[model samples]
Target: MMFEENPPSSYLTRAAHSEDSQETITAISHVLRDQEDTQLVPADDSESFAAPGDLPANPTSPQQRLAKLKLLMTQQKAEYESKIARLEQRNRELQWEIRDTQWQLGQQRQRHRLAEMKIRNAERAKEDAERRNEMLQKEMEEFFETFGEINGWK
Candidate 1:
């Protein structure tokens, strides 16, 4: 039956000559043209759109071929999106790891500085103690010398 002869009660009709119908038909034609223009070409035997000689001998109708191309395109898109997401997630993790490493390095450097300061302080303390010990030794020697001279004169 002609599409208009048994027009489904639910179908809405507009004058064919109306501007709206013309616009609608134009839009539909554009879509169809786009679909036709984007015909897939197979590059290798593994591709879904490969010709029969380039692919397995399994028979496939034109409808099946189109369906296969569409499915392949969808699968490729999903795979690409998934890979991008994973890479982004990995980048975030690496960035966090780098920040943590930098923080630890800073802490280690501070500890090293504190250790160096302690060593310097210890060296100074040792030098002061040595000087005091030498002074005490010289005073003791002078005292003994004086005592010996007095005894000898007596």
Candidate 2:
């Protein structure tokens, strides 16, 4: 944190600053990096990072490592944020779909109820028509019998 507040000028750039001042900045930043790592890796276990060929023999500056770590953390954060956004979008879409389905289901139930009511009404009409037809048939039979007796026919 202190290093960021007063970052050490690069070795290539010098403006009225003594060599001792540059060395002091480098040492302070390095100490800060070590302290930050102490919470994770042991202080004596620097070799656990990488192979000798891959790792620098001596890290004169801590800026490179800090920058790399920052970049990695930034990428991981972006990935998580993107994933969360997609999940939220999907959830909203699913909610809308569920609502639409429920509305359709309600409509279907209403239609079914209306159809059943119509069927019941048609059944009642059919029964009434059948009763009328039976009455007309009985009246016709009695009329024929009376006519036959009046005409002296069987």
TM-score of 1: 0.55
**C-alpha lDDT of all candidate models, in order:** 0.56, 0.57
Off by over 4 Å in 1: 1-58, 61-63, 150-154
State the RMSD for candidate 1. Answer: 13.8
Tell me the tens digit of each residue's lDDT in model 2 across 1-154: 1123233223213332333443444554564565346322212323233323343455422544544444445456656777999999999999999999999999999999999999999999999999999999999999988888888953
lDDT of 1 at 141: 93
TM-score of each: 0.55, 0.58
Writing each residue's lDDT as its tens digit, candidate 1 over 1-154 gives 0111221111112333333443434443443343245432333333234333453444543443544454455456556777999999999999999999999999999999999999999999999999999999999899899998989999
Tell me how far the alpha carbon of residue 40 in candidate 1 is from the true structure, in angstroms, after superposition.
Answer: 21
Query: Cα RMSD for candidate 2?
Result: 12.7
